[model samples]
Target: MAKDELGYDRIVERQLRGVAREVLLQVGSKGLPGDHHFYITFRTDYPGVSIGPTLKAQFPKEITIVLQHQFWGLEVTDEAFAVTLSFSGKHERLHVPFDALVSFTDPSVKFGLQFELKNQQVELQPADKPAPGAAKDEAPTALPKKSETKPAETNGGGDAKPATIIALDNFRKKH
Candidate 1:
């Protein structure tokens, strides 16, 4: 077996993360063009992640956020991005680094990207670190209290939730 270059994997990882960041910035700044929304999953414990106490508590390891009609105040930097999203009617800001992202999916187009952590980077922590000023077992306190009134019913049914359908296609055939 041939030995690969030591830094090649790191370089590739960096570039992939950059692509994720760029795509996020574009969608965030311009809004979803046409019928496009993203389901982004990231490691809550990654460095530079700043989330509310309630969110941390609910999603202690990982969380997937939807970028649909309710997110606001998106700002993207070279290394990370910050945005405010409403959860249970309470608005909370989140700061997530590109390195923390594990998956990015556009359900409208059924397009997605999944990443594998490069084990070579031993200095970085896994996706279970507590945010600054947070205790080891601190639960997120930002989640809104449950409302008494039920949400409006759609024409589909009486308050039942809609299902998400995803289609997978394989262009190559193996025998």
Candidate 2:
């Protein structure tokens, strides 16, 4: 098969990231219910990744974080996800761009996604309008459109009140 000059081979690869992004957005908006959990592996050195010096020193190149019992402040955007996790008794926040992601897995459902390393930054298009009654506090420019991709299905039906707040704090640290 002839490779398309338009980088068509990478279309599915890029869509895979969108799939993972949708999952994270659901988890952020609706806390993981039952046995669902995620294992997100990402490149540490990618541009826009934020990690504490201690954790960065430990996993200098790449790290896998589990989202199961004790994660806080998960904010999902079109291009990236940020969450605060307990590490050595400290709540360390991490920011990882989807383009920088290496893999995402939901072992409980036998679902997983792996992305090829795309060194360049992936600019996110503005997300669709926020759901009705969504908090007005969020700045208009930073929101990621949620309707552009396949909607996450809920067994219970209808939108559930998000159990957690989508706090957008300390997204990236300046060097």
Candidate 3:
């Protein structure tokens, strides 16, 4: 197979993430059917993400918000989406671009989608806490440097793993 010279993975990731946005807009415009619900996790610091100060204080890094029963004014546009949700008896509107989403899951049918943020957008942070004996000045290991080689194929493989599609019946049976 000839080596690729283009960044296809990033393009595919962008497309897949757009699918999530379209699906959310569909469900939000038309009410959710049956027990289907969404748990969306996104980066709080992503550009175009607007949340109330209280919510920002509570979820300084990332937040997983549920879209089930309590939301209103759902609007979707070419670049971003805005929704009004109530918190602590006060309603707050949040505007999030499709690029900000990190993970989305519809647990009713075990369906999920994950995304990789652009290199410039991803935060460099340690996962595990330092050990008791670890030096304070020690830095967390950096991610492996990405190669400049092009992708071998447009699609990774003809038999690439399928995106998770939740069976409607599975959600129906749950409730």
Candidate 4:
């Protein structure tokens, strides 16, 4: 097996994360365009993940958040993004670092990215608390399969297209 002294895999992963970040930055500035929504899955326990204690207790491992409607405070940075989403009528803020993301899916367009999260290193931040007496809405879902965008999930169109999931494992060193 040849040694990847240049760390090509890591480089590719960083670039992919950058792509996700760019998409998010645009959405933050202008909101989701058309029926294009997002299913962002991230590690709940990862460093820099700031969510209310209730949410942490519920989704200890990970969670998938829908970013179509009923969300606010869409802030994006080079490292991470923050937003408030509704989970069963309870509104909670979440701060997820890009390195903690497992996948990003926009089933409407059948475009998805399955990240190879090798670099979990992120700046630690304080846990976020729910707004005083603020009730949540609905969005948080159990971390579904890495790339399961079923035909029924795609928004109204002539025919649903199979999701294209880009996974880096296919290009990684076998050894």
Candidate 5:
């Protein structure tokens, strides 16, 4: 195999991360548009990740967060993004560097991206399907897209209501 002297893989990774950063900046300022939301997955143990000890323990390897209704303090920078999320009624703040990201997805539009880390270097892959070893029970059930989510109308089917909020597992492509 020829040596990758120019390091195109690293360049591609940086570019992909930039895309995520730009998307985050847009959402941070304007918030999600229409039925759009985000499913952000990252390596919990990666350098520059900050989460409460409980969350660290629970998701020692990785965790995916949903940014729909319940998230707050969405601040994005060139390096990382920070936000607060509710986990089982307790609010927790998270700091995730773009380099630590495993994937990013907007299932409403059927768009996604996957990242690979090999020896601390980065590579990007299409999120049309999750990369190998990406499957795990990260959430209670598989995530829901806007159309796929339909909360039973407790108000006796009065009017159609959009899905309030859901996270990583809800973002999964239904098999």
Candidate 6:
């Protein structure tokens, strides 16, 4: 492989993200077929994310939401998506930008898509106790440092790995 000069655009990555978002849009517009459901993990503090104060306080860092049943108003746009989910018996709308997404998985068919957040790296860790008065509402924080970010693995025996994930990585030419 030839050396890639500086300022090289990662068009393939962008297209992959687009394809993932398009799939979600289709699921939203239509509906999940058979036992198919989504396990969407995203950065709670991303710029375009909007959750209730309680939810933000609970999941101050990153959160995973399931889209199988008990969801409504799933609207998908070019940049972000919004849906109403029941939390603690209350319906709350969540706005998550596609860039903020970390991973999307459907365990039924073992399908998955992982995305890299722009200018941000997210490292997953155990949740800590909330600080004093941390429950107060606040704006989304800046993207976490790259050092803290880690890619999720789809390892479970040998058959659990999604073929799409491997195929996409192979198609990308590393620089």
Write down the TM-score of every candidate: 0.65, 0.66, 0.66, 0.81, 0.68, 0.72
Model 4 agreement with the true structure over 1-175: per-residue lDDT tens digits: 7678998888888888888899999999988898888888788888889999977886676777788868999999999999988766666788999999988888778788878665454222322333234334244665444344343444466564556877777678675
Query: What is the C-alpha lDDT profile of model 3 across 1-175, one tens digit per residue?
Result: 5444676666677677777788778977787888887766677788889988867766666666667777788888867788776665567788988778766667555567666776545553322322223232221122211233122232234554444632222322232
Ranked by lDDT, top first: 4, 6, 5, 2, 3, 1
Write the residue-wise lDDT of candidate 2 on 49-167 in tens digits.
Answer: 99899766666666667788888999999888999877655677889999887667675555666556765543333323322232232111221222352323432345432232111
Sequence-dependent TM-score of model 1? 0.65
Q: Which is better, 4 or 5, measured by TM-score? A: 4
lDDT tens digits by residue: candidate 6, 61-111: 787777876678999898889988776666789999888887676666666
Candidate 5 TM-score, true structure as reference? 0.68
lDDT of 5 at 88: 62
Q: What's the residue-level lDDT of 106 in candidate 3? A: 71
Candidate 1 residue pairs in clash (backbone atoms < 3 Å): 53-140, 53-141, 54-140, 54-141, 54-142, 57-140
Q: Candidate 5 residues 11-60, lDDT tens each?
A: 77777778789998998999889977778877777899999997776666
Model 1 lDDT tens row, 37-79: 7767776767678999877776775776777677789888988
- Highest lDDT among the candidates is held by which one? 4
How many residue pairs clash (N, CA or C atoms closer than 3 angstroms) in each of the candidate models, in the order given? 6, 3, 1, 6, 3, 3
Cα displacement (angstroms), candidate 3, residue 41, comes to 0.5
Candidate 1 deviant stretches above 4 angstroms: 118-175
Q: Is candidate 2 or candidate 6 better by TM-score?
A: 6
Against the reference, the lDDT scores of all candidates come to 0.61, 0.64, 0.62, 0.75, 0.67, 0.68
